[model samples]
Target chain A: MSAEVELQNVSIAFGNFYAAKNVNVKIGAGEFFSFLGPSGCGKTTLLRAVSGFLEPSQGKVLIDGQDMSGIGPNKRPTSLIFQNLALFPLMSVADNIAFSLEVRGHDKVQRRKRADELLDLVALNGQGDKKVHELSGGQKQRVAIARALAVEPKVLLLDEPLSALDLKLRQKMRTELRAIQQRVGITFIYITHDQGEALTMSDRVGVMNDGELEQVGSCYDVYEAPCTPFVATFVGENNAFYGKVEKVEGVKVKVQTGGSSFIGQAGLGLDKKNYKFKAGDEVIMFVRPEAISLKGNSKKTQNSFSAEVKTIEFEGNLKNIFLRSAEDVDIRFSVPSSSDTSGMEPSKNVSLSFSQDNAVVLPTGALALD
Target chain B: MNSFYKKNGPVIATFFLVAIIFWLVFLIVIPQLYMLDLSFRPNLPPLLRGGPDDVYTLTHYKHFLYGSETSKDAYNYVDIGVFLDTIITAVLVTIINLCFCYPIAFYIAKLATPNTARLLVLALVIPFWINELLRSFAIRILFAGEGVINNILLELGLISTAVNFIALDIALYTGLTYAYILLMIFPLYNALETLDTNQLEAAKDLGSSTVRTHWRIVIPHAKAGIASGSTMVFMLTAGALATPVVLSSPNTYWFTQLIYQWFNMNDNWSRGSAYSIILLVVSVTFVLLMMRLFKVTIGEVVR
Candidate 1:
């Protein structure tokens, strides 16, 4: 049977400071879940807690519905691939891959056969006898994975395994890792800070901020529909505007900006229950750079603004056009390089518009704008 | 390349080389050569006792190697028994020190916490800096017949007659060992400290228990340290003479005590030089044998 992991209001505090705070997550069997955050945001701490390196101070950790309390790392059915890969440098590749079996007192021939199968699985066939130091960085990465899987662990935990690799190699390994997980049909809990890696490989991504989990959902939901300002800012690029709510409908709210009022979508089923748009209540509106398009005609729409193009920057596939409204409010709009807007002159006033669905209204709280 | 070398020049490097070689000859090589030459000279003959032109002979070396109690030359000053005693004492002291020092060194290096480790290293260095003679005198208090230890034991009713605390060969071994334990431990601790702790953890996580992990991982990593520390202790102990003279009676004289007897007490410089050469050869041979057995480079073991 496959394994499911659950962390029940877990909190890990170091002396007077909390490294992870009340983290609760339920990962289903055979799911490729990822904990995504910037460095020191406790993603690795959470992964370590799952792997039984550090116990939570206030809650229970359950694996496959069994309490993992007081269990040591070696006693757990989880195998972790450390950030440095932690390969046995003195041992040959095959011996390293066969270590778990060898320790369990299996026959040498049996351990060798299993090690060979795992080597072939990781696509390092016929190179098992070579020492770990004799291999390239990418090959060492594969060896680490092979060693972790040789134990036939129900859950595999990887802590930033690709952080040491160059960018091209990292990208290539991401696909290989996902394929290996699918082939094995085991639960893979990955930890990483690079948003691209989290988005590209994880079946579900959990965003962590300040030691607390902000949101957990599919890659698209977490990226396209961020629940808070931190999620919006961290997941992707966005242009923020501070304004006050002017009116409210069933699922739509109208916010008033400098010299302009526009309709936007209301927060939908988000965690903050107090997020109701009463008239004159201050809030912030988030619009992605690509969502807002530059228009030549100055026509009024449900959500539209008139601004001047301050500067234009070419970024290979896209152009970043900085804009400022007549009231001196700054805005940025991104357009595809192939757009005919390349002929537009700088410092000229242009109209910008986007559908209300593309606008996300963030409630005024700790993350509220000035 | 020739132009580059000419610009930076080889004169400075050549000058440094010649200077080092000259210093070595004056300080080390020349003295060693003189010692070798002295080992070959015969003992002073009675006919030239009042003159400087003594005839050279192999009488001293011959007596040292082949003389027996009944042989006429056995009455000569060279006593093979003395050299044999020094070699045996040196070997016994080396073995004893190794047996006691290795475990403590391993614990300090591999097991103690950081604060405890610092304190242990500090504790080891304290006695090391105290004058060796003062340290040996301190050992007298511990082994004194009616000193503090005997007094405490009497109060505890553990023995009678003070137990002759410094009795027999025990005193010599105790004094020499107390003085040399740190020498054996410090090198071993340094070597064990360089070992990567990750190897041990990896071994344990792979399923080997604590004891098995030590045998497979910790022991192998500490092999260089053990070999080096043992060799140093062996060499130093083999050549030690002061402890036997100060702490033991003539019946328990060590090999170096015998070497001293030949050189000074009996005025036999030729035989003493021969004994010194033998000690040097034996120390070098043992070091080489250990290096070969451990399959480690000599540099790794020593450092």
Candidate 2:
């Protein structure tokens, strides 16, 4: 029911620009994997490469250990749910779901039967007779999912399939998509820019930037222990401090920035930085906003800094407090606000602290500016 | 009418209303009413016609369909057969235009690169700038016995003798198909261009081959374009006067030619007007039928 996909040094180019460059990933059978990146970062390009819509400029894609050169998308054991869903507007729900079967010359009875089964699988039973336009957005999403599943593809590729939905619907579909993948037990490769969806649904996430896989790991691995500044900053909200490595003491390295020195775990996770770092080497230290606390000078953590509370954004249960460092570097941290909290006035100094274990020190790479 | 008057103030609105009234009365309404008047009168010789003594009747309409297959009467079975044949030929021409333009439209809309697509658009459009009469004349030259096509075929050893292509209505079919190709392609291109390419890719990814993708998806998405294109091309071809006359021999009798002869050669304005009315009725009916069949509103086609 599932197939392992191995992308060996895949590269896709358009003229002089490589949309995907030297990409390598080994997705396990039935595993839910996600490529998380910003727009135009080549995650979709890599997915197209796996789906055989795009041929790799160099290297090859192997499914279940079989080389797939010269194979087209129709012949490949893969189905792609496009960003727009791309449902056939002319076909009824049943016909759309049974399109794969119908094209293979199956009789109406058999195709309808298969379509009904898929409709049931997507929890859309008996709603197979409606046109695609008649269905609601969420219903259409389910219909698209059912159509892809009806093909019985070994690998299901989703290209930001839920991006068009409302926030609440997108969140709801994330859970539903994961559950559906679990039920079908097929290898699902999802591509998305929304970090929340990727982290919530993927068993392992590959964070990409500029056509390169910055890091590939579990949600916890990507958040708790990012391998690059790009991954650390891009994957989630990270409170960063631009600085140079002051000293490396075994597992701990002290970074000097914003007229303050903070100590964090040295050289990425496992103390293995992608590039070697030494004292006085330029580095960026990243710690999650949630990891930083508002315990002023009385904080016990070794990693602490004083910043002016520039702004406070109250977001439901959490409140984001934007801070300006002594060197004017902006930092942000969020705290749970169950009630109408008392004033933390703007321009008031606040001490933020995080444990050394919760922070990562890596040689600086690309930073997400926007 | 009141809303239109309200939208634009009285002066400008009234001016436009007067302009439209002038157009309707002078160019359309009066001419059509006069033609209707003419259609009900008998076809008399020019010396005897247009006088107060001339009589009004449906004799012209009856004369078109009165005779049986065995009748030895002149104009016997010709009008009905000619009308039917004209419809059939127009349908064939429309079909040929569709077949020829579908791939070109799809290629320009979906497959061609930007530069090549631009070039293709120019190629499809530039010829349409010349007069259609000239284009039809060019087709006549091409299909002539000693023409470029015959010469090429003879030199290539494809045929032993020069094929008399003009003897048949090959000239009309070829000329009409070529003449309205842009009409077919532009609308189809416009429709197919708006299609989400991901839909095609999704079909292919979902186990549909290239042909199946077009059959199930592309064609359906381009339905409005096809409907509009077919309606325009069919109407044009059916009502075409120049192409058939320029390309036809004695044997190639297009319905338009019959109408032309009624008005010019025979000085039968009544029959000519009746035939013109029929052609108008048929084209309008076909347009409506196409719109209904494609489930498109007139607004959709006009758009």
Candidate 3:
């Protein structure tokens, strides 16, 4: 069972402070959506609003074209997997999964049968009789999922449920979660601060900052073409250049910083008319670490700069080269470990350049560092 | 034992151990043993000790079950009725205190803000600062014939005549409930405070109603606290003497009062000790029954 959810100008305020301010988005039925943000950025608040735990102060939450203003969480067709999993420690795995059915007046046999089916769905066969504490961390996570799914909710909301696991288990769970979502074909609204989780699992990602949704787009669009300065820096690592626009040419803009001049394409926007760069406007140019390369090695080099090699970090598949520009700005770029590295040494002068399309220039507002 | 010495050093550890042993022997164990011994002997004069008539027997214990042989009834219904009444009243008091305290404890622990909870706890504790005897007397005055409640009811025309609350045993129940209420509240608050609130939210999010959430989750988690609180309240209410004496009318007869009469008024220490032993056995049985009902061990309740 799946239903579309729409938030129309929803804002939740606690006294004067708005935890979620004017959020508006429609999640497609059966689509896996993720809200990505740092802590206290209102991602969880918005999820709560959809699950009917919180009432929006301003607008409406419409689920399947029905207003859910006065409905409590129990009446809403939504289930939440809490951050801590919140499995009933006093219950066996079967009884924990069967709790919703039990509350709906189902007999013990029916509940047990449904619980067994859900356990099989989660691939935890023969685990129904064990106590919650007897299960491992990953098993507990599955039991929580089965419990949420037993209610047959239309939308399943997850509030960083995998945050407590180790790195390896977390990665494994991510793939399993995506597969499970597709199999059930219900709308899943996942809230997390981890960018890797948001990028890898969600069909579309909503980036939030300080109670406002900065941008909502596909993983490729958010990573390759971020509309705002915050999204570019928050989503991934970026090397930024503080400068003023010197020339505006169609979709390409030239920026001049101290001791260097760079040309990059203008930032993308949902509405192109509202986002434009002009001469003398202050802006920041951002480039991903993998974009920069040695000068004269590629055909599309339009901007170039000289810097000294600072340090090289040898990661498993890639080597990260750090450099300091003539103006003392630190820059970093990565090359595959299999590439030649004979002459790159600390304090050696090197020329670095990137193509225009790989870099984006946007009007500086709020950077993730700030 | 060695850890104790290592933690506290030899001299201090030895001092504490000796003190505990001395208190256990002289204060508790010896008195209980003396009562047990006295309960099995015959009630006699001072000069009869070691004489042929002075001997150990079950006469005093038998006296509790049957009155003098000349009595008409087969069993002593008056004393037995009073004993049963005392037990029923104690159970009722425990039930009433639980019903009153569970919601208050939950509100203080989970629903109310920290400041409001602190203020509520302060309010609950301030009244208990007054002596229990004075509080019981205050309750007696409030429920008396010409008391504040009766006067208000009469003035408002809710009743044409004053109700006999004391004769109806309402005043005694109220006084006992008031006296032992804090014992019930604190244990429940301690248990409920440790409950992770995420569990409650998870239950709600899973489409469980509020009442069902408590039935399946909250009350089950608070079993240890309920057992401990109920056992303490029942025992204390059954053993209470002053509150019943202050609040009861002339018609009311309490089991403790019979024990008091046997020991003091009638100078029959042996019969009083037998009744005391019986009450002790019943209280212990009630505690065991509470443990069984809650499915908790004594260790859990103590914790």
Candidate 4:
């Protein structure tokens, strides 16, 4: 039901501005792949290139080991669900779903029967006679999916299709979308800026920035070990400390920063992914909040530091305690809200600690936000 | 009206409401009533016009359908024929204007760059700044004997003889279509501007060919605009006087030209009022039929 999609140095340019610059990646058949980036990062451009709405300025887009050059969007065996869920408002639900088949010269009976089957598949059964406006936002998305599926496309492309939905429905639809994709067994290329959606739904997530693919890997791999400064900050929240590398020992490096020498597992600090590094290199160590713990969780082998508490953010199950060292270097860690965090108050002093393996030592690069 | 006063207080609200009523009655209602009254009276000479002798009759209306049968002269089939011709031309003009304007409007709204779209709108508008009468005469000059079109065709050897476009109906439509085309383009542009480009892409990705995409998606979404533009163009083309008078040859007449002749040349204000009323009725019917056909509500069409 699905096929492999590959991009070979694909670049899309609008006159002189590069919307997508020299991108290369491979998506497996039946793989749920998502391109994660902020707005204007050219993720949508790359998706459009695959769907045939955009032609790459430099390289090739291939599907199922076949070159897709000179092919129009209609001639390709693919379907795109739009950001706004572009369901046909004028047509009945059945008609909107059956439209792809209708244009293929199918009779009304066959179209109606197929539309009804899809209606049941999308869980909107017996609601085929209603117009698109009569349905809720989630139902409209289902209709759009049903319509796209009616063409029996081997690859399904979605351009931020769930953006218009509210948080509850969006979370709900995320599970539904993954289920539908699995049931259909088609290659799905989803484009969005929300890393939560990309992480939750995609088997593999491609982090894009400034018209470039920063990193492409499994959700856990990218979130756990981001390769670029942009990816580390953009993919999820991480507290960073700027420093210079003091020494490299095997796969670990010790960074001297803000008058404190911190040790970390060396990863992700190079001009290019393949570049090597040495001592005295300027770097930033990024640590996830979950990686740091209160002094109780710190083992004898870990390093610890004392800092004054600045703010306490109480999320339902976890309390985020922001701390600042004597040198004014800021760091934060999340502790289980039930674990006696009552003392974690503003202006209160506390000790934070983490193992060297959890802190990623990378060459200083761009932060997620200015 | 009471709510209006409640909302804004008594004095200013009453003044505004009464002014609106006064304007409607004095400007729109009174003139329409006067025309209706005049239309029911028999046609009389200029000196005997508005006399007490012949009034309150259906004779003028009957004369429009049967062409003054009580007269001691040849049967004037021209009036009734032109009346039908006016309707048919109005419909044809509407259709033609739609065909010409839809693609341009869509391009401007959805395809062209914003600057290009602005320039194209200006292109549609700039010619109208030249007085409409002069534009109509320009059409006549272009299509008349030994005019620009004739000279070009002669030079290209497409035809050895000069084509008298004025005698043909083409000249009148060329002018009227030009006159009313801007009216068609604007509404369609307004409607199409609201369409999401993603919808068009989604249709193509759903395996719809270009024509099918427009047929099932674009046109249905733009029905209100289509209805609005078509009705306006049809009514205007049907009631237009300058094009037929300036561009038509001898023995050719438009319904407006007949109204003009009845009022001015024939010295029959009653018959002319009847003709004007008939044009109004036909125009209203066309508007309502367009609204019905396109499934557009009054508010949607106006919007």
Please say which candidate is ahead in TM-score: 1 or 3: 3
iRMS, candidate 3, in Å: value is: 0.8
Q: Candidate 2, residues B1-303: lDDT per residue as tens digits?
A: 899989999999999999999998999999999888999987676787778758888777777767534577766576788888889889999999999999999999999999999999998889989998999889999999999999999999999999988887787789888978888999999999999998988888888878999999999889889988998899888988888889877776789988999899988788899889888887798779867876898877777
Native-to-model Cα distance after best TM-score fit, residue B271 in candidate 1, in Å: 2.5
Q: What local lDDT does model 2 show for residue B252? A: 68
Better of 2 and 3 by DockQ: 2
User: Candidate 2 at residue B287, lDDT?
Assistant: 76
Tens-digit lDDT string for candidate 4 (B176-238): 889988999999999999988878887888788889999888998888899889888988888
Listed in order, the DockQ scores are: 0.41, 0.83, 0.78, 0.80
The digit string of per-residue lDDT tens for model 3 on B122-238 reads 989998999889999999999999999999999999999999999998999889998998999999999999999999999998888889899999999999998888888999999
Alpha-carbon runs more than 4 Å astray in model 2: A269-276, A296-300, A339-343, B1-15, B43-55, B67-75, B283-300
The local distance difference test score of each candidate is: 0.80, 0.87, 0.92, 0.88
Residues A1-370 of candidate 4 have per-residue lDDT tens digits of 8989999999999999999989999999999999999999999889889999888999999999999988999998889888888887889999999988888899999999999999988899999999899999999999999999999989999999999999999999999999999999999999999999999999999999999998899899789888888899999889898988888887788888888888887775323342245788999888898988877676643757778999988899988888897768888788788878777678988877888888887767787773
Q: For each candidate, what TM-score against the reference?
A: 0.85, 0.94, 0.95, 0.95
| First chain TM-score, candidate 3 | 0.97
Please list all clashing residue pairs in model 1, or write none if there are none.
Answer: B85-B255, B86-B255
Highest DockQ among the candidates is held by which one? 2
Q: Estimate candidate 2's RMSD in Å.
A: 2.7
Candidate 1: where are CA atoms >4 Å away?
A257-262, A268-274, A280-282, A296-302, A306-316, A319-333, A340-351, A364-370, B1-23, B45-64, B67-116, B145-198, B243-251
User: Candidate 3: what lDDT?
Assistant: 0.92
What DockQ does candidate 4 score? 0.80
